[model samples]
Target: MSDPITPTPEPADADAGTYGPFAYLTAPNSVLYRRVMRVLMVEKERFTVHVRPEQVYAGVAVDGGDAVTEEAVGNALESLADGRWGNLLAFPDSSRVTAIEDFYRRRMLFQLSRAGEAAERALAQYDAALGTRGSLQSVALEDIVALLITLRHTVSEHATGATVDAALAHQTLRSLRERFVELADNAVAFMGSIQRTIDLHDADVEAFLAYKEQLVDYLERFINDLLVRGAAIAELLGSLDAASIDVLVTIAAEREAVDAAPGEAETAAASARQAWLRQWSGLTDWFVSTPARESEAKLLRARARSAIPALLAVVRALHEKAGGRTDRTHDFVTLARWFATLPADGDRHRLWRSAFGLTPVRHLSITAATEDAWASADLGNVTPWADAPPLEISPQLRRTGAYERRGKAVRVTDRSVAKALLVDRARQEAEQTAAARRRILTGGPKPLSAFGVLDPESFRLFLALLGDALAAMGPNPETAQVHTSDGELTVTLIRTPGSGVAVINTADGTLAGPDHLVDIASAVDEAAGDLVNWAAG
Candidate 1:
């Protein structure tokens, strides 16, 4: 083996000739250059750092077929090792030379340079990003909650002047930030991919349906998890006092700044503290709602819910495509099949005429006299055009080309009575609905069990309010508040601690569930203009 090639320092900008780690990517012989580097890198992984030119030629020939030759591989390796490109470190294979003539041959062993390896890895990462179909990570949410809880305890201990472990604080903060970033990024990516899937125009029907079904289920599961964890995270964040949080932030910053230079420790700590505060702000804004706008968690949930209807619409379109009610193509195909089954030319011609009715009508000028004469006559298929009797034409039609008497113009029907009845019925129903709202709002906030018996309309309105509140909450929530879709009522439900079930008797049946303190109020002040009159008929 010859001595390893000693790398030299890169030349100045003007002398470097614009060559870089990625220079070979745009070169005319980039394909062959990449293949040579690939073979060398693969060999390097196997602890064969130095590869003979013949081995490289063999690998390149296999992957690139008849395009690569031994001479071509040698030339590419030499070009890559030159001072300009510098993608490989070349060594002479002097041990294989038996005679001086053999020495004259440019036999060399090649090893991939550091820059070349880094470029390959970067390209590999790029390819992976292109193929990635990101997913909603519920586990990340769980991890974030766990971290916040730990930090809260840590802050409480520090507040009481207890010694805190700086290393642990740093690690916890780092991990929390990392997990939060992963959650936010993956959610954005997942939602984007879902939009693409929904906008699929030419996808196979069966395949798209299967994917969309599973996608909807996945979204629902994630949304539920998001609601529960998001609320918990927001509450935890609010529970931490600003002073306690500052203590933890300082501890983490000091821990991070330990690696800084002696004179720069204070400056580094200040920078780290600022960075930590910024990250905390980001985390807080993601889960905590404000007066300016809603939290990202709630927005993501709404987007996910909207996606369900869009997916259903696509499914409906696919269903229509598979089995349409008025399929003209099917009709034409069936008619063609019928024409194909006919035996004789005459029979086919007759079937075509009967189906289309587009035959010439030169002898069809009928008059009242001819119509009476032919009333008892046989004009069947056996009668040809030449044998058929002639029909008389009216003298007025021949002279003026018109033979009908004029009549009076028709009057438009009057629907005032029907319109009045519809208006009266609508007014009555709206009054009834208003009465139900008033009845429910009479007894302020109380335990569900105290609501007593209810009319059917009141019972239905109560159920609707209950459903809206529960849906706004997660699968298992202790307290929830929501405004009905009609913007007329706001409902709040709080689960009370007990083993008793709240029983509500309606005119139809008795309803029982976990006892909850329920409150229903009119949203007239907040949504006066947007209120909708929800009436059941």
Candidate 2:
């Protein structure tokens, strides 16, 4: 337990100060005042609502030590009273007075004020939130499912004219909402913590590596639970009609409406119902899928799945680090130290050459006779250059530091014939492709069956366009449209109800599929038509 807060001088009245109830927190003696208030608050919790000045002194003295005098404690208590910061309520302790001398002392008691208690609660919650690393509570999900089932059954009973417990219904709904809130908040926090863990920020490398095996398993288990249990939850949510949900909301709201002010029962009920309905809507959306969006459950599962790979990547990195691989930076540092200890500049230069081998060797200009002798010799043993015969260097290389070959320059080959053939072949292919594209687009929008018999070139082009459109269509879209890879044409495929298969004859084979409404139009711009044609080629 901590000590209470210090106090300031009492104001003329409870409302005299312009400061709020927590104003003592910023005062010069705020520490002492907070200690005094904490003592009062703790005593209040223990059913000692009104604390005496001596009690406050004893509590403050625990942490403050002898530095906190009785006079200081009394002054701190008075400063926190209703007249000053309104952190405490001052009461006359007449029951303790025994004689005229005791009466003159004016024994008083201190209790925490409503504003003061609210401020303390806020501070306590702030501290808790700051420190909390929330978790993934799969049990919370189970509890939520159970609550929803209970509510569903209760609503059904109420609908069929069966006796129902309103209080139980309200309590169950409240508990369900709270549990859901905790689950969502904890899951988000846990996922965030996992990311930080993966980054290895502030984590012990060895410990994290040891813990990661279990962490990965934990995430995997949670993902499995979510997938299995999430589906059941979504099913339950879908089975409950809006009217049934509204009935339960109404029951919970009416039960709470009793707390409203006089003559405001109807208004309170309506507000509570609206609030409950909004919460219910959020709950439904969290589990049930809509046309425009996937449920949060699916998204959470995807995030968890992605984290598994990331964790493995981190583990791989850690393993590499632990493999005792040589570091480039460390090698450079060691090399620098070796260089630093050298006694001579020439030795340093030689060490640098031996270490890097960046210096060029100039003895490659050997004569034809010498090269033949060196190649034919059975030379396996090492021979220092100092003990070997000198190489025959060319005069030009010795003078200019470069070898000059003694020969005529090679003649450049003529490629104009090959270039002309390639150009002609590309032109012919481009012409054929453009003709095929035009033949398909010229027909405009028509049923797939009406395309009739297409030439091989046109059929290939048609297949390419159809493949692009279908790829854009995804799983079960009613219609899909896409520009060709060359952006010279746009193809659209729209499925129709009760459509039959369409077969198109080609020289190579036949193609068959749903007789969809197919449309291919030229999408080329006049400015970029040349570019598009070149790309097609």
Candidate 3:
């Protein structure tokens, strides 16, 4: 008979060996022995069952720095099938499998690196979907909530698995967090886009509905992640409580109220009711509102003030809807009272100005009648209308020819009037110009002749004439100065120890110095003769 066939014992009883989720080894030679033996013995069966053992054995043999034999290969296959290599393949065991796992982990990291681009594409798709009217037709708050849930689930799953290093692990977690945040942000952005598009489409009711859907989506997530999460997240969520929900609710309710109306009167009544509801709702909605930080409070206040124009616009809309006319004077007084009670020096100024219709004055004009009345009135008797003259002329004025005046009174036509006005205007303009000039002149620490407005050429000419005249004088020099007063002109010369120079000043002066003075005098004499010649012509 052929040698008794020693059937390969089934893998189950081959090791009767203990196994664990992770692998380990003994000690000393166990370190190297287990590392070599684990891949050679334990992994062989799994590899041979799928493919050739030699193919898998080649990698282990190379790593173990050994030559493989058929017996060794068979033993490795048997041990792997029996699961007896307990401590041998433990995570502590640095083997080719660990390297393979590392390779795959790196690959996952590379995939994750592209996640941002994927998210961007997803966001673009979402935005495109929102832009279409058909996509919004049956969309509801529940749909957005469902989408968020899906996103959260997908991100959470992707974060799992030990296939990443510490750095990659942290990156993965951060990516997940950012993805959730982006989802929330995108939901908000999509809602806003939808609302804007609807508003442009002139579907106010639809726009309001879209806004309500956004609020519901945001508030649900806010309440869930913030209120249900750990204490830290809860605290963070609580910080967002200051956001005014009533504004959104009021907008929706107003639209609903108007849409539900059967007639104009009913619409008006509904609008009035909505207004009252909004006022109370606004107060109640913010009752628990507190900023997380002083800076946040400051920012909120600034933003609130910035929104005053929008608030007033809404109020005006509601007023019109209610068929109630706005009384500007009453509104101004009401606003003034409100502003007076506000905390000083916050963002209240902008709101206060808006509410009171306080606008920058572009131009101002005082009528002649108003000016005259102001002139006649005593300061102690001044009132709002104190400068407003009575329309009807007084009987005393009729007898005085005040009513029969052909044109403006002599007081208005006096030459002194124009002169005084001109002088006053000129003085004001001159003061302004001088102020600017002074600023430019004093801009630097030291003064320079270049800062002066005098033309360089003119100054050079005057200096040259002075130098020429000084040279003409004797060694003990005389300096002459010329000046004009009113219509008269004068030239004077004085001798100085160092030099003698001549200066000339003219009423309509073109040049200065002794040379110019002599030339000008000669020209005047010549002109007198020319005048006679021209008269003869």
Candidate 4:
């Protein structure tokens, strides 16, 4: 209903508001208004704002201070209680005439009305709004998950029926049982927290992602761990007579009996047996009975199993939230709707000013205290930053120089040890190289298979030698010895029948397939083994 262009705070009603008695607050001088209001706020309990001009300026007078006087304080008090500021009423709480008998004793007392209370509350609210507002932080699901996992592991270890000392078992059970209960309780609590986090206006996307992932991982892990423990427990429950861990059952039964006594003092053996019989109902409910109120261990497994799908559903909800266009914020969307329907130049201009505060800067001034303005208010020839050198059009421009590696030459703590390590590394390298060569040298000099089927490396070698042998066939079908450049090995090329000139595919033409053969042999060792690939190096 109000003008949006020049939006401002609603003015307090002059006749109806508490500030009516403190009308001097609207004075042109802000310091006096604030100081007087602060004094009232600080001493609101005192019925009389007993002002004495002498006491008001006592500290200032001690420092040889300024022009404050008794008349000034009295004038201020009178002005505050005047008919113009109708919110205050003057009164005397004195029983004796001596209350105002002397100038030093004379003081003004005033009580604030309903309007003053309202004004003070408004100011208090303004001050309070300056504090940091509460912000929503995404769920810390991973921490809870980690704690639950630790508790699960502890339960698993104890449930294995290891022969632990009685005291140790008691301590471990007490500690782990407390932690496990807390973790289980927190799992349910954390789901509510997840919903709260997702509902937040400014939820951290990265933190939410982490929380979602950790929670899903937690649920999956719980499902797996619970299944394993459940199977083990079920087996233990089903095969109590067949197990060698019967001591575990005996110890548990004893523990149950001791607990049923309802006191700290240990019962005698006969009394313990009586207690055990009395408490057999608990044991029956726990490990003996298969129906009607199953044991807590089975319930734990069931809850853990059920929680997986519940967590998965939560994850689906989170994903649905994440997989959407963040079109705009709520406040901005509302503002945009208002702007669309505003349809007025003045309203538009006011909206612009209110949104960005683009009104002219009022408090800035330029003074020639240090330096003069630029000589000309023009930038005709000014150029952006550049090197004096002309841009070169060459590969050198694209080139990058490699940095020299700088490493501190650490003194070897033990010279012999360093030398031994270096030698061992060298020996390892040499042996690896030699082993590759040995595999390549042996069993590779045999005749080419029918249809020229060869290993991948051997096929490459065939291609390279095919052209050379074909070029220098020299009109003879006898074997040709081609010594390699290094002459450490020799390749003997021999012609063989191709089973009546088989035709094969080729780039130039269908090849009259070669009958040439390659027999690999080391020059120094006639009985060399299969060729090693390292020899090609």
Best by lDDT: 2
Q: What is the total number of backbone clashes in candidate 1?
A: 0
Q: Candidate 3 residues 334-388, lDDT tens each?
A: 8778778887644475675565556543233334675687578663322455455
- RMSD (Cα, Å) of candidate 1? 11.1
Q: Which is the better candidate, 2 or 4, if ranked by TM-score? A: 2
Could you estimate the TM-score for every candidate? Answer: 0.62, 0.57, 0.19, 0.23
The digit string of per-residue lDDT tens for model 1 on 1-537 reads 444434564433423333376788898988777777778778888999788888888889888545866888888888988866667777777788788677777667777777666767777688788888788999999999999998998887787888887788878999999999989988888889989887874477778987877888998898878877887899999998788778878988988789999899999999999999898988888998887788888899889889889988988877887785557888889999998999887788798898888875754467677777667777766678776666677777789886654498679999999999999999999999999888888446788888889999999988888887778775456789898777778888887855366789988999976677888888885454344433321
> Per-residue lDDT for 275-333 in model 2, tens only?
99999999888887777888888888889999999988888777777798767998999
**Candidate 4 — which residues are off by over 4 angstroms?**
1-202, 241-537
**Candidate 4 lDDT by residue in tens digits, 1-537:** 321122122235544634465466676643443444445554465654543334433433343434455565446545655656654445543433353343334344554544655666677787665442321111222332343344334345556954445454434334433444444455555444544654652456557556666756765566555444444434443443323223333443456456554563345434544543444333223323253455644454456555556645655666666797344586688888888998786787778789879675444332343114323333222333352222332343235432222498778586888899999999987676445334334344444434333344444444555556555554344667665456655566677643234443334334444344556666756534334534655
Pairwise TM-score winner, candidates 1 and 4: 1
Q: Each prediction's Cα lDDT score?
A: 0.81, 0.82, 0.40, 0.48
Per-model clash counts, in order, read 0, 15, 12, 15
Q: Give me the displacement of residue 58 in model 1, in angstroms.
A: 7.4
Which model scores highest in TM-score? 1
Which portions of model 2 miss their true places by more than 4 Å? 1-36, 57-86, 89-108, 200-202, 323-537
Deviation in angstroms for 59 in model 1? 6.7
Candidate 1 residue-wise lDDT at 320: 84
